[model samples]
Each structure stands twice: as C-alpha cells, then as structure tokens.
Target: MALPLSVLLVSLLLLIAVPDIYATFHHGVHHAVGSRAHHRIVLPKHHRPKFKPGPWKQAHATFYEGGPGSFGGACGYDDVVREGYGLDSTAAVSNVLFNNGQACGACYEIKCINSPQFCKRGQQSLFVTATNQCPPNYYQSSDNGGWCNEPREHFDLAEPAFLKIAEYRGGIVPVQYRRVPCKKQGGIRFTITGNPYFNQVAVWNVGGAGDVVSLQVKGNKKLKWTPMKRSWGQKWETNAMLVGESLTFRVRASDGRYSTSWHIAPKNWQFGQTFEGKNFK
Candidate 1:
C-alpha cells in the first residue's frame, strides 16, 4: 500500500522531535532541581562545597532566654557570637537533629508554617547554626514540657532567631526545616587548652559540612600523625606532649571532605590561645 504524503511527513517529524524531548527530560532527572529559594545564599570562594540539600520536614520551634555569655552548650563553644556565629542565628536542636553533638556547627533553614497569625509571610527563612542541644525531659511527656523527647523533632532557637520566623507569644509554632551548608567567614579556629601532658582542642568556625568527624595532630618533631579522640562534642584531645613543638592538624568533616592546617599553632603556643588554619570548601 502506498502511504499518503501527509502521513510520511508526520512520521518524519516525530522521529526528529522524540529524541530531543527524551534527552531534555533525562537531563532534568539526573541534575535534580533545587528547592525554591526564599533568599539567595552567597557562598565564599573557599566555602563553595556542593551539598545535597535535604527535603523540608515538619518540626516545632520554641525560643529560650539566652545572651552572649550563655549561648554555648554541648558543642563545647564557650561563646557562639565570639566564635563567629551570630547571636540571632544560633539554635539548639533536639536529639534527632543534634545527632549526639555531631550536628554541632551544622546549619539549617527553618520557616514557620500553618500559623499565619504569627508567621511572617514573604520573609526569608531563618538560617541558623546548631550550637547546642535541646535535651529531652524524661520527667515530662512529649506533649508537655518534654517537647524535645525522643522521636519528636524540635528546635530551641535563640530568641532572636525564633522571632525571625514567628512571634515570641506563639511559644511554639509548626515549622518546616532542612539541612543547609554553613557559610563561614574565615578558616577553622582551634582553641587549645589543657596541661603539658594533655592537649584538648575545641574546633570551631567551621565551614562547608560544619561538623568535624575525625581529627589527627602532628608535632614539628614527629613524622607520624597522632589520632585525637573526641573529648566531648567538637572538642578533641590527645595525651601526646605537643608542647614546645609547632602543631599541625588534619580535620575531616561528616561529608568526607578533609582539610589540612599545617603549623597552625606556633612552637611557643600557650593554652587558652586560639589559632586559625585552612578550612574546607
């Protein structure tokens, strides 16, 4: 049978267009579209590590009364503001989000939802660092004073951070939140402490993944790196006498990224002094 002229032309058009359509769809699926941006995040050149942003999930938020001297908690940070985290941009996440202190320094974006009366619509979401932990109250039920109880995700935001998303009078408001990479200003800061026989270091001002998973230290006289154990939270310690020797540090974050800071601490470094070193992207 002889095909009509119009039918042959239609068949030819389909062959040409179908492949292009399939390619476009395939690219979209592989690239993965990012979430709608409430506000543009400007990352620094050294802080531009690509991270897979998690999906927004439901949670609850409340505020606690705290100030500069009182902001630090389980993360080993003595003063969050002095440590580079803004007073209004810090929060204490519950156990689920705190990840047993591993969540320290991790950033998150949160916004109030389902509470039009208190939620300020069209405003940028609240971006905060997990500086502390909202401990679970075994003495109270999850619905009562135990809002941070197990299985319940909650955020005890700093008063200022809370007000950015909801009115203080709201006490607690429904919110949607997701993990975000921290954008830090400078290199990682290491606060050294302890006696000559023991060395305890607190890691802070971290960027990128924002949480340290493992740390190793080497002295100027030593060829092999000495692994440091996590003393508590972001604090890692080693018994090796690093005194009188210039110190180098290797830090690894949760994202599997590594940064080496060579001779960050001087040979004459003293306890209670802090030094800056290379940061991760």
Candidate 2:
C-alpha cells in the first residue's frame, strides 16, 4: 500500500510540471528559473493591396440596383450617398483606421458606391408621388432586399459613384420629394422615401412649418417636381411675412436622403397696425 501511494504522488507531480518544463525549454526563461511561457498568436496587420487594371473594375467601381424607394440596406442605386467615403488602402483614413484599430470601420457599413448617372437635365424632386425612371440601358439589381443583403463587408462606393454621374449632369439629382405640411408645431409635413437606402429630402421658400397655409403641385415631364408649380429642376420662390413684417424666403432641394437648404434671405417688410373698435360715451 505504501509503494502504490508513492507512485500516485510522483505521477501527480509530473503532470503539474509538464507545462513549466515546456515553457522553460522554448521560452528562453532558463529551465531552472521556471518562468511563464510566451503565449500569443501574433497576427500580421490587415491590409488591401493596390489592384491592377483588369481586376480593378470593382476596385474603384460602383454599380446600382433595385427599384425606386425599395432599398433594404442591401446596397442599391436608390441608396444614400456621399463622395470620398471608402477604404482606400492608399489613403490616410484606411491606414489610420487599421493601425489604430478604430471602430469607424465598424460603425457605418459602406452602403453603396455613389456612382455617376446621365440625366439630360438636372434631376428634380416631386410631390404627390413621382416615379424616378432609370435611364435607358441601365438596370438596377432586380433581386435584393433579402438575406442576400447589400455587401457591407467591403468598401461599397456605388451610390456616391452614381451621384457623381448625376453631378456630371450638373447640380444634383432629385430621387424623391414630399410636401412638409407646415404645422402649428413649426415642422413641415415633408415626404420620406420608402427606401432605406435614401434617407432624406428637402423643401424651401415656405412659411413657418406651421404657417404653410396650403400646398399644391402641377407636374411636367421635364422635371422632378415642385408645389403648385409645373417644372422639374425649378421651384416656386415665394415670400412669407410674420404679421406683415419681418419676412424670410428659403430654397431647398430634396432627393430622398434629406432636404437641403439651397438658399435663404430676409425681406424688408412691415406689419400693419391693429385697430380696436369702440363706441364713444
């Protein structure tokens, strides 16, 4: 019984010593010193190499897909866009984002490349529902908005690429527009796009968000749209006065992403005096 107990004790001791022995032999900590092992899987920094011309199509390339107002975060044409937003390993942001491990790369997925488009006239916004007809020979991703979501794993710069094309048409393109009904709360009842890709639209030259007494529109084949107006790429410039004094007029453009203030200015005007009717005694 004593011999068996001795064997059991020695086996337990060897098991405990194996890890230290390995560390001592390989880690240069000196076997007699019995120090901890160096244990970490060192990974090389992540990087994107510059591409050659042939495979470079998607390199700085972007494309569009999907119908009007049907963006489902799946990278499509009707998606929101901004220029100079992508991972360019040759650029500073990419270099910094990688070396420092910033979450900027994680916060917002590159929806789609803002590519270019060819509209004969500048793009226009509309009211009372206007359809954005894609140019001929151009087709959006017919199949999207499902589990095959927009590719966000990479630098998707398609929407901006599309906008660049439209910009080449001069000014900006109006994807969709809605009336912002002026309410007592001072916010206009503006239209929002059904597409998640596009996030905003705009309207200008109107009274208080609440002061908008009414709105109407007449459409033309030439433009996006305007309220009580009949043309695309054009707007109704009207004046609004508070109490017949202190006036202001503003202009705006909307494309479904958000409304933008084109311009604004105050006019010199005055309110008339109020009169109180009374009978003399």
lDDT of candidate 1 over 69-125, digit per residue (tens): 566678899988888897899998899888878988888899899999888668589
How far in Å is the alpha carbon of 73 misplaced in model 2? 25
- lDDT of the candidates, in the order given: 0.87, 0.24
Among all candidates shown, the one with the greatest lDDT: 1
lDDT of 1: 0.87
1-281 per-residue lDDT for model 2 (tens digits): 35798899999999999998887677664543443222222322332222111111121212344433332121111311211123221011112121221111111112122333443234332111111111221133412222112331122223433443244333323221112322122322222222222222222212221112122321222222333321121112222112212222222212111122221111222122111111001
Error of 1 at 272 (Å): 1.4
Runs in model 2 lying further than 4 Å from the true structure: 1-134, 138-227, 237-264, 268-281
Per-residue error for 38 in candidate 1, Å, reads 44
Q: Count the backbone clashes (under 3 Å) in each candidate.
A: 0, 49
**Model 2 clash number:** 49
Which candidate leads in TM-score? 1
lDDT of candidate 1 at residue 198, scale 0 to 100: 89
